[model samples]
Target chain A: MLKGETETELEYANMHYFFNDNTIITAGKFLLPFGQFGANLHPSWINKAVSNPGIYGGHGGNGSLGGVTSIMNDTGINVANTWVLGDAGRIFTDFYAVSGPRQEEGDHGGGVEIESKKGDNNDSMAFGGRIAYAFLPEWEIGMSYYSGAYSDDGDLNYSAYNIDFNWVGSYSSVRGEIFGSTAETEGEEEGEEEGHGEEWVKDFDKSGWYIQGTWQARQLGKSWLNPVEFVVRYSDIESDFDGSIEHDFEEDGGKTGSRIYYGVNYWLEPSAVLKLGAESTSIDNEEASHTSVPDDRIFLQLAFGF
Target chain B: MKSIKFVFTIIVLTTSAFSIKAQHVNDPSLVAKGAKVYSENCARCHNARPAEEYSKKEWSVVIPHMRAKAHMTGKEALAVEAFLASTLTADVRHAEEYTKPNAPKKSGAELVAQFGCQGCHQIKGEGGKLGPNLDGVVANKGEAFLLKKLIDPKFNNAASAMPKYPMNKDDVKAIIGFLKE
Candidate 1:
């Protein structure tokens, strides 16, 4: 809705058959099961902060992802199961093969990351998976990775690695995500010339990370203030390219540097939230290739999920 | 590096799978375990809904969807399924039977096992960290206070997440007795 190209996304519609009480084999389009964010935390109702850290790669968002972008879900078959440990601690695992990402004309894959694209560009299939260990009822640590060919001829390869974690405590909650990717750029014949620096031919070297902390006022002994959450987050994406250009954002100058956000959210219901926040996004000038400073802005948002 | 990681993932999953075993569907302890799983996993995604709102049919659909969405283990899903199923009626809730006592006075160990107390509190290094370790709980908190706390989790802190089980005085006494030992 924010991008105005409101195309409905049908990311996955498939079948999951349980082999036993602990194992499952699923076919057709399915969740990539990468980091904690996309699989477990992306739903707006659950997210504690207003801005997404650039770890989970995608075309465009408040802050364009750096180093690596995740195509959330795609056509594939997956094997997944959980192993309960001691009494409550358990390790969860997921693995799958998908049609893989395709290299687009421009840098950004755009809002079309999911629904608009149809068929794989190359014959090569992408493989990836995640493994996570959760314990203490409120804390989890995990790692995820993916690799595949995205070029038309299936020569150029795209691969990425991610580590993420989250812990919810009685008085505070903290979470973070970090991911990086390296993709071989498919060269354009038009700009091909000897000894000339062609950006397209340069590998997309991008990486980003962010950490957020949120606390409740329950300790104050005020019931009314307990529902208010104060959140602060710092995130950035730096690479060989710029986000506005690479992600196909319609903005004037496509620069992605670093961002910090301070927000206060009040809960009306568990799913409904009223958010008031301000953010300062600074583009690091040292990274000359993909550099720009977007203006800081304040926002008031009323968001809820059914 | 990628090959090593791929191999590592396989090893973890393969080894974990060997430990999977079929559960006896009628086990009453599942309800207690399910109660813990639901509290731990559900509040992360959305607000907690009372079991009163969902019928057995709605819960059947909800549990599987939640399992896939949150990547819950089959055991976790089954335990929660059993937990919610037991809550359908008061008689069913209280009647969810543990093993019948062979003798008149049930052993403290039996009550702990029946209630799945260690599912949250670490007992002899074999439980979750949801609750404080029971190793020194008896000494720190008196036996009388512990009994009252079990009867009323929010007796002191109104915001405690501890669930109130429909246990009688003898059941509570057994748990306290086991801790004192």
Candidate 2:
């Protein structure tokens, strides 16, 4: 869906499936899907031979700024101010709030994310508010804060903030942004999985951030026929569990070692583009990473505008 | 005289050697030749493409259409097709015509707009319409009639109110590619 600053709104959607070999099957509300499908004969008027992914980058995709506003979960239809100055820079002020899943602290020394009665009364009805400004084209900076309300009426609030900077060069471009999150949660007694008659007063906090850069179109064999772009970023987070919660949970301080991302974007066409990337995150104190997960992934994307 | 002959021979050999050493595959002259052919045989009906809008497929389709409609035979059709394809496929941003240090710059969209073409045509679903709807017209009309119209709009339509723009060989060929989309 598209709603121009001026002009009536339009609605649209795209559904597509991909096979491991990279062959794609697509069907949508409008227009022929990019490649072939069962019982779908291409039109003679349409030159399928000239069909190249590079032609219409993200032509028929759903989401990412072009869709019917009505289809959006309008529970939080907030407003934000946007300003762009020529080719040199841009600035924007955003205000937004939405409801859904939220982070809840679990029992100490327990399976991560599983809630036991003794842990903490952190179940929540959540709400968030943010006011931020960005100066762009090359350089940018920003900040935000959020909070959630627990069922017990006790407060489990957390605040998050960030700063960023970037540069655009002829052959390639680079950018770096840092973020920090701080949380103060009220804790319960030592071994209680369920609520106990006496509630203990305790405070816990968590904070972390990262910086990353990307170099694109560097001199390489890929640059001759196709422009290849590369990006890398590393991030880390640490938390301190305090008071009675530490004794029962057996976790007073926890840290996420570091996460690294390596990504590449290919310019398949003037308007169409594709990105492939992967990430690996190591744990500082655990025998295994979360899910013992492999931080390797590859994806291809295409975008086009009409 | 003998020494002079030796030096001349050496100069010839040296020139030949240097030329061979330069070995810059001189980006296929066939396209250049095709450009000339287009200007001479097809520009009257189809204009060349601007830097951004042309493509190889467009040129290929154009070749056959010109052969069928304008009667361009073997060599002429091939050459014009080559030229049309070159501009269509070359990165318009890096093309010399676009990158001159002091060259007046206009966004490709802006150039398309300035030609007053948007008044009658649209690319990829945008533009006005005093002319035949051109979205993929290149795929249909081929190059012959398009180039011909550039030189003389009335060649195909005695009553066409469109004025024939002043265009040389390269410019006409270039426009053909631009309209390909």
Candidate 3:
């Protein structure tokens, strides 16, 4: 069972059957294999930081704060396979088709609505796939692409493309990812002709990128405290729309900004961590009237993977 | 409602089946081989977690998931499961033993070697060339100063890459004793 701020839901209820050593088929509501961040690192325990990167929060929506970038669970079928490359390399590929996101009636007033990307109903089908290659024990690279219908009328559509890579050495590790997305919106002409009051279409072009590096102290010396890790990360998200649109991207606290995060993590165990970190956010449109200054935040989080 | 029930039923049965198949192995040679596999493959990405961290059931679920991510073959995965099951279920010290007073006491040189201090600090003409030479430095600095540096290297030097060792009092004293010698 998965519980969120607004809803308590079952995140993934999937059935998988293995065909052989290298192939498997799955059916049910599953996490979409969209990108490395969403598929692997979005979990609170697995993610290095307290908060997710701004871009994984998904794009354009009602004044409400739900988007599809992270935890995009959908009802569908997925086929996955792995192939060994030489002695120390492997290639993995996943293909899936699932019900896409939808805009549901929001609890807030003023005709505001929230986006429901989870598998509520198969209003429209979206198809996508991901391919990843581990060239060495310490290195991996992946590419992801997803496209689906997002509107009840099937007029609005969405598409996303991403590239992510990770490399881990004896003492330090580096990870980076960049993604861009496009979604159709109600044009100004449609809003005017319908006479139904609605917000104008914000820019549909959205892109985000982040790079993180972590250094483990235990590798350098012998101390019970040597398991401490120093981490530094920088992330940025840009939208085609100016600050005119009132809707907030759920993850970024409603503003497009560049963020620098530095933190220290004490590994109680490999799967458990005590983290202290600070994030500095610089809003892109400081002069805009509707834009609010995003304050730098300090956080301490205890995360453990069971 | 019916679909939910069906899904729930399938999950219960599948989990039960997996649990039935999971068992611990007592073979020493196999356990040793599993340990080597874990150190070589699992330690490549992150620190190898202590086996005592999870129960057999927990490892039953966690190992398969990680096996998929780490691209472990069937045989390798099974060996890792056997290793984790045997180790975690057996009497063992937790990974953070240095924090406990009951931790096994080691000589200062053994602690230094265990922590790979020689990789960066030189005792005589040996060890890595990154940090300052430690030869005779302990005599120059008193035991208090040495203890402070051991507990938190960054207390005096913020830029120091030296990690905090969170050692028990006895372990710190032992290391200090070795340095004095």
Give candidate 2's error at residue A242 in angstroms.
7.3
lDDT of 2 by residue, A20-139 (tens): 111222222222111111001112111111111111111233111110001111122122333434432334333333231223345442212211222234334233333323332233
Clash count, predicted structure 3: 5
Q: Give the higher-lDDT candidate: 1 or 2.
A: 1
Candidate No. with top lDDT: 1
Q: What is the TM-score of chain A alone in each candidate?
A: 0.82, 0.51, 0.82
Q: Give per-model TM-scores.
A: 0.70, 0.40, 0.67
Task: Provide the lDDT at A44 for model 3.
Answer: 61
Ranking by TM-score: 1, 3, 2
* Residue range B69-160, candidate 3, lDDT tens digits: 55565556667776665444232234455346666788998767554455456676665433456888777767888888887665554435
Q: Any runs in candidate 3 off by more than 4 Å, and if so which?
A: A1-9, A57-68, A104-118, A188-203, A222-224, A242-254, A286-289, B1-47, B69-71, B86-181
Top-DockQ candidate index: 1
Candidate 2, residues B1-181, lDDT tens digits: the string is: 2343345335544543432111112234554444334433322222223323435565555455444333343444565554444444243446575567666544434444334454334466754322456677677767887777776655543323343443345566666667664
Give the higher-lDDT candidate: 1 or 3. Answer: 1
Alpha carbon RMSD to native, model 1: 7.7
Across residues A111-182, which tens digit of lDDT does each residue of candidate 3 receive? Answer: 112233333433566778889888654678889888876666766677888888988665777998888777
